[model samples]
Target: MNSKIPKSIDEYIKNFPNEVQQILQTIRSTIQKEVPEATETISYAMPTFVLNGTLVHFAAYAKHIGFYALPSGNIAFQKEISKYKFGKGSIQFPLNEPIPYGLIKKIVKFRVNENLEKTKKRIQKKKSKPNHE
Candidate 1:
């Protein structure tokens, strides 16, 4: 795990190899463009976007890039993303393939909405609970 936290996502991307840096920059920009309010941070040694809550996390790997939208993100994109390789909460995009920027944007947007909905539901649940004396 990288012990240092990047000042900004741009700084984080700059630290990677030129090729990986380009892809990472694209991913970072896409997330920022879609979720303007998202805060960039280093979490789990990877770059993470925190919106209404923790929205998504991405990392540069040896042969591919890993995008993680935890909880149920993989399940949501399973069918649509079957062509690409993936894991529990991650989807891997090989360096050779044209990076799927559009799909990545869509996934980030989906995660933002998902987190917002979860927050709303949690608030509603709290409101419905009777206060104990």
Candidate 2:
């Protein structure tokens, strides 16, 4: 495994195999296009995109590439992702299968909206809190 944490999504994609690298690159580009404000980094040993918090993460596995949108994402995509193997925040795309780039983009956009809502709520909560100091 590469010990270096990539500064950009392109460098992160270069760390993977040729084919998987291509898929990762496409996913990264789509996310960037959708969420221009998001910052890229390697978190939890996977390539993560963050806005107010983690928006999504993607990593290469032996037989599949995993995309993690966290908590509610799995539930939101459950019906569309039912055919594929997935966990709470992850969906595995088999190495031999075609990557659902559109779906990934849609998920990224949804995450962006989710993060914005969270940030708004957090700010509102902070404003409503009493300062006792």
Candidate 3:
């Protein structure tokens, strides 16, 4: 990993080798395909997509690609993610093995819907609130 933090997703991907760059690009495009409206930026030194909130994040590591789809997203696809190395909210797709782009797409789509629903609920709550003034 580079010492200076990346300012953008393209800069972050350029920091890696050709093989890793391709993998990162595919993952980025997969997330984009799932949530084309999501904005891309660098968050926590990784590539992150933000809509109403963060839709998903991914970074290339020495041995694996670290993916953060939020805890709920991981819980939602426990069976599929169980095959990878995972923690509370993050999953690692090993560089050696074939990356599951399809699963990544699904998880991203789930996260997009989750965030959108939460945003909608928050708006509804605000609209229903009684004005104090």
Candidate 4:
């Protein structure tokens, strides 16, 4: 891609036009509101939200906004997300189409809870294991 890779979500959204920036910000804020503790960073040249692991990623394209919630998130919300164009783990919300912010919030919240549960399970598993000196 000829576009410059942004170092942060703010920088990434700043590169886009005003309308695109609004969409990107709304997506960012929705995710943030869902997981207030999640860290914001740039990964794969896109805006990435990280909790116990990667919660989600989003990028603005020429024609669409690419929202990635990983395979688990996609699988969990397959029925609702299937309406949009998608790949293995990502969905493309067209610029002209209405972006489903409510659905996105639900997905992000689900991911946050999922990640937290997984982290707790891992911790419990480790606690159960005997020390090997």
Candidate 5:
């Protein structure tokens, strides 16, 4: 939440308090554990994981942590996430509440699969297209 754009996830996490730092790292690890091949970066000033496209993005806010797994991810898990505060592509997990690591893992896995499927379709589309060259 500083003016400086964190070059890496580590830098972004360090800007938070110890408790928030712990939560952020746990979320990062949960995503990585689910998809070992996912790449990490700082996107939109938050810690982001990318596979075929962005897997997920998370950031610590004053009273809550914002978890973004894109619109598809949120929509797919609508029932499970309904209890929490959510948006088109984002979920706000309050700091006072227990962070649902299990739910986070599920969401990450879903996004990983979704992203991979998109990549597959893109490849198939290219294969079906007539060569112009």
Candidate 6:
């Protein structure tokens, strides 16, 4: 693990090699295209985008770039992401192979919608709760 924490995604990407930086930038742009309103920040030591809540996160690794769209997004896009290596909430796109920018865009869009819906439900639930005094 890197001891030096990056202040921004640009700084994070700058630490990597040119090839890795390009892949990271592509992932960032794809996510931005999906959720232009989402706020960008560093969370969990990675590039995180938050809308209603944490929309998604991405990080560059030595061999692969990891995309974290939360567990629900992985379950929702199982068919597409199955082609690549994935964990509960993260997918690994290898640096040697072509990154699936299209699928990444879809996942980001899915996460944005999920976050929005969850936020809406949370607000509604709060509104319906009886006053405790």
Quick one: best lDDT, which candidate? 5
The digit string of per-residue lDDT tens for model 6 on 1-133 reads: 3669899988888888888888888888888887888899999899999998898899988788899989998999999989889999999988889999998888888888887789899999999999999
Per-residue accuracy of model 2 over 37-118 as CA lDDT, tens digit each: 8898888878899999999999888799899999788787788889899988899989899898888988888888888999
lDDT of 3: 0.92
Q: Go through the candidates in order and give each one's C-alpha lDDT.
A: 0.85, 0.86, 0.92, 0.91, 0.93, 0.88
Q: Which is the winner by lDDT between candidate 1 and candidate 5?
A: 5
Ten-residue stretch with the least lDDT total in model 2: 1-10
What TM-score, computed on C-alpha atoms, does each candidate reach? 0.89, 0.89, 0.97, 0.95, 0.96, 0.93
lDDT of 2: 0.86
Task: Show the colliding residue pairs in model 2.
Answer: none
List model 1 lDDT by residue over 1-133, tens digit each: 2548776666678777898998998899899999989899988777899977899999887788888888478788788678888878888888888888888888888898899999999999999999998
* Higher-lDDT candidate of 2 and 4: 4
Q: How would you encode candidate 4's per-residue C-alpha lDDT over 19-126 as one tens digit per residue?
A: 999999999998988888899999999999999999999988899999998988899999999889998889999999999999999989888999999999999999
Provide the lDDT at 30 for model 4: 89
Q: Name the 10 consecutive residues with the lowest summed lDDT in model 3.
A: 29-38
lDDT tens per residue, model 5, 57-98: 999999999999899989999998999999999999999999
Off by over 4 Å in 1: 1-8
lDDT of 3 by residue, 1-133 (tens): 7799999999999999999999999999888887888899999888999999988889898999999988999999999999898998999999999999999988988988899899999999999999999
Q: Candidate 5's C-alpha lDDT? A: 0.93
lDDT of 1: 0.85
Model 1 error, position 91 (Å)? 0.8
Candidate 5 versus the native: TM-score?
0.96
Cα misplacement distance, residue 118 of candidate 5 (Å): 0.7
lDDT score for residue 107 of model 4 = 89
Candidate 6 displacement at residue 76 in angstroms: 0.5
